[model samples]
Target: MPESAHVTEEKTLSESNPFPDSIPERLRAQWNFLIEVDKLKTVLRQSPLAAVERRENDAEHSWHLALMVPVLAEYADEPIDIGRTIQLVVVHDLIEIYAGDTPLYDAEAGRDQEARERAAADRLFPLLPDDQATHFRELWDEFEQRRTPEARFAKAMDRLQPFLLNWMARGGTWQAPGVTADDVRRRKSVIGDASGALWEAASELIAEGERRGWMRPGQG
Candidate 1:
């Protein structure tokens, strides 16, 4: 090789030097985020459906709800932005990486859980570029309010999910963890305005569970 050509190649390589060890180098962020999300698998709960076995993790729940959005789209109460609704469902539970699932009955505990979730979102998503992190945080916040139609539909699915588990899992996980009638009622009430039909369907399912003795009497 020519002497001038060798110097040029060495200089180019030095200019491409990587980010420091203390920081998340761009390439490492994606895998690190996945690792954090995978930790959710350890945070399982006794299911309401198959009280016999625990429910799936936050990651599974998020994907499952996202898939259900297309089929359930027609039933939403408000005219929804289906794309936005889908996006919200996809990222909603990322906060659980920091704040574990807070069940309905734990009022005091549930209160501060949202704060922790927001912090987790910031840490996990900023691993992406600035635009991506901001957009994701906003989607998560929108779901939190349940104000818009898209958010409402997303919220309802989140609420309905547990019932499906309990209904099919033979009991929904209610008895094993001892979710009471009052708890079931309060949680189901939130689902009403989001999708009147899905809410009614959930109500019917709960009633049937009660009838068959799958659920405790007076629950829902």
Candidate 2:
């Protein structure tokens, strides 16, 4: 096949839909933003998918967290707006579409993770329409600050989702070098801030992992 023929075989998203010149500017911006975020599906994380051999991507992680909100909201430490919590979780990691995933166990990467994500948020959020851009950015901010009940529960779901995945993976990231049961306990303890019940469940799983020799007890 000729190079010109091959070029058409692999079209970039913008090329896939050659928008008409008459299309509204607002719709164009919105469509472009949606297409850009498709990159989220490519940003892989440390947690393995429960049913798959490969790591989950940011898109899958965010979707799992959003789905978990309704199922687990009843366990929250305080009442939260379920819809708002879902929104927070959905937007929380979209910044990762640009900043890229920082694995839970990577302390060196974590040291500058916030700075990188903040810069990402600045660039990515504005891709939406002005109103949606502000709203989504605020939702992202709330999830990061974790000040509101919705944000807290959203964050708890975020932490718990990977914890559940690791258990399903039979230790997943728990098996990373030098990672101990106590380390898992300390990192996942934040789940308690929003749901003591979920934390208790998670605690049991951590203990079980230790008992199974998946992780050492570390300092504790």
Candidate 3:
């Protein structure tokens, strides 16, 4: 082959395969972590899409929450760092890639959820470079603890998104056997700690769901 043609072929191969043998360990680790988290796309949740028949997955759920942070920032009970809040939203559910999703209403499945997710985090987060793995884990832990304003607001969006989905689907999960408005109210009441306005709106949606016979009537 001509030298020029050989050079052109090498260029094409190099362009197509971006990874080089000398790539730093940090870059390789970060790339692997990004690729591994793609499994979140397959981790399905209980909430249904408002416009379609299928359920949403964890990746979609996190993206929705990230979007909600900036759009609904004004409703947060206290001021929040929008970028940090979005980061918290994105990190919150990545562990489900390894742990799998636990439905909000599934008491049986939830019994061991924290243990499962903690184990999953131990395996998954270390895929990243050490600094990033620690930062992301801290964000995940913060979201779980809900101790900061950003974490609280992030949690509110987490709770509120599924609530909105159920309302839009005309009782998506609420129609499940043995679930009731009271159960939902108790579970989602954390929304109040972050955003009273959103929680009030959520309460209204729950009441409307009960009125429409979408929810099992809770005994007073």
Instruction: Give a tens-digit lDDT track for model 3, residues 1-220.
Output: 1001121121222234456658897897787677667677877888999878999988899999999999999999899999999999999888776677888888887888898789878887887888998999999999999999999999999999999999888899998888998999999999999999999989988988899999998775
Q: Residue 163 deviation, candidate 3, in Å?
A: 0.7
lDDT of each candidate versus the true structure:
0.68, 0.83, 0.85
Give a tens-digit lDDT track for model 1, residues 118-220.
Answer: 7666666775556766888888888898879888889888877777876777665556455665567667777887878888888777777777877567722
Each model's TM-score, in the order given?
Answer: 0.76, 0.91, 0.90
Greater-lDDT candidate between 1 and 2: 2
Quote the lDDT for 10 in model 2.
Answer: 28
Off by over 4 Å in 2: 1-18
Residues 98-179 of candidate 2 have per-residue lDDT tens digits of 6778888878778888887898788888877899899999999999998999988988888899999999988899999888
> Quick one: best TM-score, which candidate?
2
The better-scoring model by TM-score among 2 and 3 is 2
Residue 67 in candidate 2, Cα distance off native in Å: 0.9
| Candidate 1 residue runs with Cα over 4 Å from true position | 1-35, 48-54, 176-178
Candidate number achieving the greatest lDDT relative to the actual structure: 3
